[model samples]
Target chain A: MAINRLFRWITFSYLLFFSLASVASDELEELVEDLEYEIEDLIEQIDERNKRFKINGFLSAGASYSDSTVPLESTDLLDEVNFSPEAVLGLQLEFKLNDKSKVVTQLVGRGKTDFDIVAEWGYFAYKVTPALTFRAGRLRIPLFLLSDYLEVGYAYPWVRPSAEVYDLAELFSSQDGMDILYNFSVGSVDTQLQLGGGTLARTSPSYGGLTFKATDMITMAALANYKSWTLNANVATVDFVADITGTLLGDADNTFTSNGAGEIKFDHLDILYYSVGAAFDNGVWMFQAEAIDTAYENRPGPQIFPIQRAHYISIARRFNRVTPYFLFAQNRTVSASDRREADAILAQAGVSPFDLARVFTQLLDHTQSSWALGINYSLSPKAKLKFEWKLIGSTKGTVGDFEDFAAFTSILGGQDALDGTNVYNLVFDVVF
Target chain B: MINKINSLAITALLIASPTLVLADLVVVVHPDNSVSSITDADISRIFLKKTDSFPDKNKATPIDQKEGNPLRDAFYSKVTKKDAAQLNSYWSRLIFTGKGTPPKVVRNDKKVKSLISKNADHIGYIDSASVDDTVKVVFTLK
Candidate 1:
């Protein structure tokens, strides 16, 4: 009887253990299901966040070397290779306020400037209709085809845009303005027309970070896209002034003063810009050309009203993952060298006019031409590696945008060495 | 009987050559969409975000397959004449300039059909073999 009782007890305990194990298994499954739901909810939350805010960025790291000590396109390459001149990173943030309105901000950091972050774009845009858009605040001054995305290296084929055309009007990069964009199609061609105006208060980094301020700035642009071809035209005008007290013409002569004032004020100056560009790409081959002219309408001083015309043509062909490109560019000051103002200023300052006249001629009679052969290797769809060899030249006895011309010529013992100088550039570009 | 024979023939062709069927893509819209056909130019214009409406003046929304998909490559090459790199470059120019944005991307042909079938304004491309009654074929790749 005792053996039978022990057997029954063992059977009951076994059944009880099995039931408890099944209960625990059910609870475990429930816990896993709940975790899965929580994970899915988190993913949905992240997706919703992404829909409201978007981020994009681009980076370019470039190294350059030049045979001469002259800076090209603000690149401080002089015999020794320099990496910081072209190294830049840009971040763009787009916050979607609604289906029809958004805010965008872009920040760029440059290695040359010690990686100082600068706000290149901060604007609010509203889509009034499918074909029209309105934007206000700090907007890029779209004077050229690439001017809007100049620092976004992955947008174009070159390590840097041809400096000849892009460098001429560097004073106007952005303006606190309002613009309206109208898009329409004519036959098979897509066209966009932009009209904008505002005041500009910014420093001209290209001109040694001089304080540049403008009023009554007006700009108009047109872009037409037909299949693989894109054509752009732009015109802008501004009444501006710059602090040219320490640099440029004023610095040429220490005794030089404007109206006996300690500093020269480039005030009440009227400037005009005209630009035209065309680009064509057919999967295998690409071609681009742009021409620009900058004219000072008000000639307060003969040396002050300088007119410049520049152009560049680039042709490239793609071979699988590699592309080879060739470019030719030229820049010329169309204005004649008139040293009348310099003579007057020198006479007033009781300084010898001969040296000042020569200085004015050297500075005003600028001419430069360059050619480049470059190859770009696609690291991926969003990245590229480029190597370029470029050579620049000028007319006899001219410096052609090179700073400290007198010292450079004296170091070379003659002006013939300034005729042609070779520059090498290597760049890696990526967009995300 | 003719439709039955055509289906049989297509099944035979698919069984005989899968790569050919893979390249055979059909642009689709919701079944209720009134638009029946699209021209090559209009297709490119819409996909490129150059135009936001169809020929019938109905709002058009474009959807894209994930990057690196061979089907996406073939569709873009045949319709828009743009490769992956070129498209990226084009959109990069637009995005930073605040000009426009590219189309929303889905995972695959299945997701494309699912999305297109749920919205009358949505348009996407899928393999011809995956075409079903849920989505209407607006254009067939030639």
Candidate 2:
């Protein structure tokens, strides 16, 4: 219901602005000239405050195909080709109050979300000194190297970042937060440290949509750049309360006892996530690697509390306008003790044999590895085209992160538990 | 008449080839600026918004030429070791992430010079052929 209201508000705002712009179209040219003059006059009148404003936007459209007939988790990844999974558009506005202060806002619409506009970030910043800055309001959680600009497709070379590493933790990307950033130089190396604290309340589109409210979220990050090499390290922790609306576990009786109608609740869920990464780019060759670890604890249900560790390494070489890249990523989940405890409890609850099997399968640790080969071509200064072929394989388990245990086992049709999937994607991304 | 036209074409090609092969870009600042010389790394850091002030602690405001200008392309390639497209990609990350913004853009070298001359801390780049007394050349890329 809240999502609906937000969507309607954004739509109304856009419509009202367009209507007003159209009504004033005849006088727009003259009005623009007069506005410029007025701006100059105002600048002179308010000499102490220098103000500037800018607007920018990005768009991405793509089609993807997977060689599996069964859908992957709740995502729209099916056997045939599809366009709705990856297309997105975003707009950003910045109002510079002066050299030391500014406000920024960004809105994004995605095909997967039925083109509903969502506010991605809105924040105010003030520079305390050349070496220190402060920001407050809604901002991205700086968990990964690409977290700051993950939705801006034109900012990265690949059509998408490595999902194995980035999606290891089901955490909100943005929160109502305050952060302090400090930048300094040690000899010839540039270094930066960011410390933040925040709270989050959002409905994430994972697991058919899960609404979570988290508090006391704290984060710390450090980065260093020397010559052509850059390194980054980050850590974050949060305590959350979630109401699971989707059937994550195929059998609800074995998983959780609902407090009310469709209210599968978990309180005081604590999570910790950390990552370290390094990148090297020298105009011709580029290489990047990152390792992420996630742990979930303090849950009051038979759900799997996976302790996930994931990593990826990518290398690319540029030949003028074309770049060819290769990536390898893997994720491993450890939940043996958690699953054993859940199995004993469910057995004591007198669960049926078939339901017991399903619950145990869902609790097993899932592991998967993926490899991708792609090429990026620069069409222009603002546009790029990318094509990638990826292969994902699992050993001793179903593909982790791609599908829940019940969905994966159902797709297997009693075949071998190991599975392999092939996917291909072509995308064009631009920013203006 | 055909030979006369062929000679004219050859003359035009000869005139254009040198401009393409020998385009020199020079970074400029106001004449009153305290700093006289700058390293390529310093120039990159300034333009990329890594620092807001010069080594002398004076606030710096970098300016840029409009996209697709040859001088702009040459400047980035020589100073930052990045092409125009790469720079655009870099700026997209910074701008959308609210980390920093690209420099203010002007139409031509004359405007760059004019802006630089009006502010002692302002910095810009232009074709070496346009160098004049109004602006001081801090760094040159050939």
Quantify all predictions' global Cα lDDT against the true fold. Answer: 0.79, 0.77
lDDT per residue as tens, model 1, A68-182 = 7555545656779899988999999999999999999999999988999988879999999878999998988889999899999888888899887787787787889899999
Instruction: Summarize candidate 2's per-residue lDDT along A1-432 as a digit string, tens digits.
Output: 434544555576557556654655546545544544444434434432333777899999999988776565424677888998789999998888888999999999988888899889899999998789999999888888898998788888887888888776546688898999999876557788999999998876655566789998998999888777889999999898777544453345325342111112456777888999999988789999999987777655444545788999999999999999999988887765655565565566665535734354353466778899999999998999999998877645554655565455554567543357788899999998
TM-score for chain A, candidates 1 onward in order: 0.83, 0.81
**Model 2: per-residue Cα lDDT at residue A214:** 91
Name the top lDDT candidate. Answer: 1
Q: Estimate each model's TM-score.
A: 0.84, 0.82
Worst 10 residues of 1 chain A by lDDT: A256-265
- The CAPRI classification for model 2 reads as acceptable
Candidate 1's iRMSD: 8.5
